[model samples]
Target chain A: MFVDLLFNLRAQGLVVGVGEWTGFLDAVGRGLATDLDGMYHLGRALLCRSESDFDGFDLAFAKTFQGMEIADDLREKLEEWLRDAKERTEGERVPHEFESMEDLLEAFRDRLEKQKERHDGGNHWVGTGGTSPFGNSGRAANGIRVGGSAGGRSAVATAMERRWEGYRGDRTLDLRELKVVLRLLRSLAHDGPMELDLPGTIDATCHNAGDIELVEKRERRNRLKLVLLMDAGGSMAPHAERVEKLFSAASQMKDTFKSFEAYSFHNCVYQWLYKDIEQLDRVATSEILAKLTPQHRIILVGDASMAPYELFSSYSWPSTTTDAGIDWLRRIKQRSPAAIWLNPDPQRFWQHPTVSAIGRIFPMFDLSVQGLKDGIKKLRVPH
Target chain B: MAEFAQFSGTDRYIADEALMASVNAALVLERPLLVKGEPGTGKTLLAHAVAETLGRPLYSWHVKSTTKAEEGLYTYDVVQRLNDSRFGDADVSNIRNYIKYGPVGLAFDSDEPVVLLIDEVDKADIEFPNDLLRELDEMAFTVRELEETVRAKQRPLVIITSNAEKELPDAFLRRCVFHFIDFPDRERMERIVHVHLPTLGPDLMKAALDRFFAFRKVAGLRKPPSTSELVDWLTVLVASGLDPASITEGDPFLGVLFKGEADLAAAVDKRRGRKSW
Candidate 1:
């Protein structure tokens, strides 16, 4: 029968009835009775309008709630549900297997705080995976999630398998592994007979009438070279790790894939990033292709998070073949049939000052990341 | 601005000496304070919430790609200026001083202490922020056309923010103290989410909170969704017509929850079969 806190705020002409008032109130209730972060949140809800204003509210909240004692006298149940403040999660990094983005964020934030606190102390700033490398290498990083494989139900496809699974739940084989299997299956395509080499071996095995034995044989051996160029930079850091896991999965599938090398780049693909224990940085793209055969497919992964200048500017990282960054990308597009810009950043951020400019230069742009079920399904490898 | 204030909480965190000190300093120091941190970290919420406690008018200038300084200050009324210039033989001096006020100007005109919210300062082009440093630092502007100076006299509380996408020019950031907002701890978040999303059952709160912490450990996330995002996620889950177990299985939102598509994709793959991996 009583009016709620939200109603009171609405009466005061300070709260909106639409959009997100309920969510705001829920957070404030949590903050009022819980932590400074909640208090900051309450301020953002009431005061800020966009991403930047949170700073003012935060400064204000920190000042106001520094010594204030929050009233936590809830009617019994709320107390037990509150996530305790002292339970740090750096050493005992728990696994979060969420089905949706919502659960991922809530669970992820919890891990972030412990590492954030560690970072705040001026220790372990450089990422060393989920385990905090400051003093705990044998343990999991406070906020990092270089998590183990989810399960075999997870796609064995290093890259495309995830896509295939997302597209068609039929895992006749891992899509990423499928790419390798396709190459392997193609490689086994030989011109010679299974148990015979040529005329002599054929005569010895089948004893065909001399001179009357005539057989036609075509030149064969699977030849498809794939060169995957991934952007390795700040923006690509997170997605790159996941993409790497996919690569690891594909590599482990002994029966499926042939050797497909991967390379990482920044403004331009720096050097090829390989799963090989010997980390090679071969600059000769042609030599690498020649050795693997031109038929190999080139798959690139990266968030083209470069300054706008990197695209059209003449002086921006010049290659021997092109004058500008855009020209260089065009050259690569010409050299390979399957060159794409696999942006790690979201599509919305694409309009962002940097991404749009880069997108303009790279025409064959696919904004999907390597992991979404649909994204992996879209990878076209010559099987 | 009204679009947001109506839905936001006006109390929870207010009237702290630190905020007042910062706000009062913005008024007195006449400098735009730069705030940096993760998105949804409440960078935008401070001004409105503080207004309730400060008992002042809060004016917000939402920064975007086309958010020029002129847009923030005053747009030229070409026809009006032309009409006034031609009709009734208005004096040149009178016409020159006839500029109207915008959000920045509104802050200058307020009688009470005002809080100016410069949301997502990082999103704008370099020039927008560059143009404001002098106005923010000196709290004064020159009207060369009128040969006059219109000083704020009482500068408003200034709050500028960047998600740290690109480092702001040093000249722009020199105006105020800097603070990095650390995301709330698990217990803190649990308490907050529990209070905000009361509709969710206890098991949900416990399970969601525990799982959330575990996630932050792996899946190298981009801008961990702020407390606000989680609150919405939980609220939607409870109201989503799905049972608790179903809610747990249906929560993949890397698309909505983070700025990186690939990161979420990777997270999904990392989570392949394991519900809690």
Candidate 2:
């Protein structure tokens, strides 16, 4: 619905992006989000979010209103109707049709616990791990571990093995081991400062009545904020969408990070990235980029397509400026070992004179597409 | 309402059942249903059925670039509030009572289910969804000055439509059931035509549909005409007393369905050259 609302609004002229929608949802799940007006947060959320992506969103919307006279008439009609509603609500309460989000979660948890108890009472358990890619399946495997605790080395290994088994994916596994995989794949990863789940620590302290709702409803506090600077133009065009998809995937997938912010940089990063990619002021943006921390998991999106001698050739992206995007990248990676480059340009192309030239500057940049998932894997869980 | 129900029976068609189920369930669950599909797939009709079935007055909010959340909700009428404010203690309540429930408010107040149709929610800014989520989750909201929660007893069934431009974030996807409506198949399209245009002869309908599919096959159309458009155009042809002998006259009405000038020309040329499409 979020996607639906997004496109629907876009059709009408309001244009929210996937990033904003995610942030809004993150805000809602954690219960920190607020309403701006009666414009309909729920309505927008339910109908506008799309899984196939932002492609053709506007075209579809324009189709729905082909002979729509109602669009014009309804605006004023809606305002009048709203007036009538508040008028009716003057003295009494007008309870929302939907339950409290907190209440809904409570009910959902209760139903889940009931199912868990019934399942646990049976021969098999809703145990351990499984590959819960989108986390849409309620991610049900909480507590029925195969003689292990929730956090630890064994848990980690069990998770990896479970994922590995599923990775082969030819054969299906029993229920118990599947949960192990789900927890491994989707659970948030944290290592410092706001580290909610230590890399390998297990604390068996909890009240008996406590449930695993929090396990599914994650707080953004554990997220490791990343600032991605992708390179566009040139050979990067073909892989632009692919690189962005990875960025999109990582944006929603990574629990190790709080939030991910992305920017596009050409040959150098002397300044800040424009929030809107269309507008970038060299002097001011450079100053802003300088202020951003190098601690971000700065994954570069461009296919180092510059001339082989380009970096040493002495001309930066726009040239003659005091900014070196490659240098900022090297500095950022030094602070966070997780930084990696994603290029859709094939590896065979990597040895091409142009790529070879860029490679001389940044030797360890992995040049593979399938390696995208792997690179992101390294960023969050650490090799 | 009758126009559309009959229109559904026209010579042209769209296939949208999975979307129907999702929308139905969302309403049953009292959760909003978000529908994303191509431009001509009938996203708005689902909202129409909801309003028809539930007996709730339909409130349509067409999102625009400048659309602000504040505008969708209640706006203050200072004179009304101030005038009522002095009437008495009851009048104080009246000040807050300057009710003109917006679509969101109508969903909250109407004793009957109000279908709040946000026809195209994608036009707003990236912050739009976040802005709407709270009012949706709360069903009841606190207008800053009210110092109290204005809760809705009646929850409106929210129907949002979109064409997927990009993948929505997981956070946004979490709030409701999402569905994508596909274009209808040949058999269904024929059936739809029969339903909307019962008076049309079967052979003529089939011929018209054959041409419709042939036209849809040509790539590069911005958006193929919707069932409603096809039906409207066919009606125009039939009412104009167009003959199978002179199909060339239907060329002007082709604009209603095919936006591509080249495709339209090709389709027209194809029809003009043949006695039957």
Predicted structure with the largest lDDT when compared to the true one:
2
As a TM-score, model 2 comes out at 0.45
lDDT of 2 at A236: 65
Flag regions of model 1 displaced more than 4 Å: A1-383, B1-10, B14-31, B83-98, B198-201, B249-264, B274-277
Model 2, B143-230: lDDT tens digits are 6645666677777777777654322344555666566665677887777777678788765676577667776765435456767777
- Give the RMSD in angstroms, all C-alphas superposed, for model 2: 24.4
DockQ of each two-chain model: 0.01, 0.04
Model 2 chain A TM-score equals: 0.39
The TM-score of candidate 1 is 0.41
**fnat, candidate 2?**
0.10
Ten-residue region with minimum lDDT total, candidate 2 chain A: A199-208
Tens digits of per-residue lDDT for model 2, A179-247: 222122222434334434421122111111122212222233443556666675565666655555555
Q: What is the C-alpha RMSD of each candidate to the true structure, in Å?
A: 26.3, 24.4
For each candidate in turn, the TM-score is 0.41, 0.45
